[model samples]
Target: MHPLDALDAAAHLAATDPAAAISSLPWLSASLADDAAAGRFARWGRSSVIDENVGAAVLPRPLFDELHARAGLEAAWPVGNAGLLHVYGYLLSTTPTPYGLKRERWLTGDLERACGLAVAALLPWIGAETLLSRATSAASALLARPDALTEEAEGRTARIALGAPLPDGTAALAYAVDGLIVTMFPVADPAAVRAGLGAPRLRWNAA
Candidate 1:
């Protein structure tokens, strides 16, 4: 499917069932991407983003207003960390082996489903990636002495231009969810997703 189409479909899922979307990765990313394209963060920015892109309203009319409102503000419109973790638990709630990461058994024709499922799973990662890209771009621009950078700041913006944190080695599940969702759904943050299965309610044991 076309990338945007995939995103729209995922958004449809999210608009229909946000709780289910959070449980899956693919849906999360798609929904986030759609929402990001809209004017969710337009307020932070100096532009009207929502109206510019009508795709944000693809989902059922019921959620358009609320989602748009959420996006308008800089608040975490999409489910928060705990909600995301709750869904992640079900998606990766399978048996835990020596490795901490739980593995899922892929079924036939599940690639698309898996991709859909990964929307939520990978949004955090994708958001981090975007932040990294922006930071790198900003840093590069700063190093290049762009108009945005003035001598008054002494390139401090460039110095603090670290990209969003990625879940490379640490328990960056929060960041991971954002990055992973974007990776799959192709959206930014504060967006929603959908999944068929609910995340399992497994208890965590301390070491």
Candidate 2:
């Protein structure tokens, strides 16, 4: 499937079956892991630490560039650490791991910082009220429906690419959903699929 088509399909999944879409996160991460183990996932940059004291996020250059370009903002603009954390938190939540304890610690430890960065990064585009509203709604829904996280669904797989370049001018991040391989920088377009479910505009601050 085409990249946008894959994106749209994922969006449809979120709209029709939010629980299933949420459950598919683990499979998506698994697909990413497989690609990474084979070196095919280099397009998605390596994970790095975000230092709150310095108020800077260490993101992949290409991913950063894509976000900047999409937002139509200058390179000098600060990337929102809270936004970055939100992205990370989502990833952590979706990751398939037996180490629930470790995951919980990591999320709870830095959730506030991540949310702050997210607001900073996204506030310009969506405004503070909208961003907060969307973020809260999303968090509430996911948290309220724990059963959604455990349900299973089935569909064919397609590779969808996000509109970002790697440092080497290759693809950025791509994951295999049930019927789509979604290629997108989560930071650039956080909660895009979920937003399609009438959540809110999670896409970067695009003016």
Candidate 3:
């Protein structure tokens, strides 16, 4: 199973069925737990950080760690990976549109900052490709700039072909693009996804 398999499944499902996406949360969280325990993702237990000082109620890390431990953990949204997941989860579930794309909101400063940690912790070692995938460059860019994300020319987030690597050296990008897809939501097309994501197309070695 890919580290991000659960997330990708939810993304595609949200494209059509958000109820299905919400219903799948327990299963998704369980699958995510397995993946984490498998060591692809280190234990994502609660962090000491808190974002309550601001108006945004980030899912508390302790609660996230608890609910995250099993498929059963549920709580108010605080600021952490679970908060990111929860925001997307609600948007994906309640929307009538595919992926709730047009409805997606840009994350607040603290939440966006939290994603910086998630992206770094989640990104895997990708191999060089003859022509690198969009994610490689995007990942490089997101690390440098959190507010800027991959968007299509029309300016909606697009899925940038990031997923499980082929296990061969040419596997391309990894956990990055998939994370952004649902975390960010749709723009217009894939090409713009790469462009709005910020970062000039650099050679794999250069990236």
- Winning model by TM-score: 3
lDDT of candidate 2 over 16-52, digit per residue (tens): 4443443444433343243334433222222222333
Winning candidate number (lDDT): 3
Q: How many backbone clashes does candidate 3 have?
A: 14
TM-score of each: 0.24, 0.21, 0.27
Error of 1 at 136 (Å): 7.9
Select the stronger candidate by TM-score from 1 and 3: 3
Looking at model 1, residue 90 earns an lDDT score of 19
lDDT of 3 by residue, 1-207 (tens): 553455456555654554455356554444444444444222122221232223232333333444334433433434333322433233332223333321133221222222333322222211221001222233444334433434343332233343222223121121232233222222233344445646433211110
By TM-score, rank the candidates, best first. Answer: 3, 1, 2
lDDT score at residue 185, model 1, on the 0-100 scale: 12
**Better lDDT candidate (1, 2):** 2
lDDT of 3: 0.32
C-alpha RMSD in Å of predicted model 1 compared with the true structure: 18.4
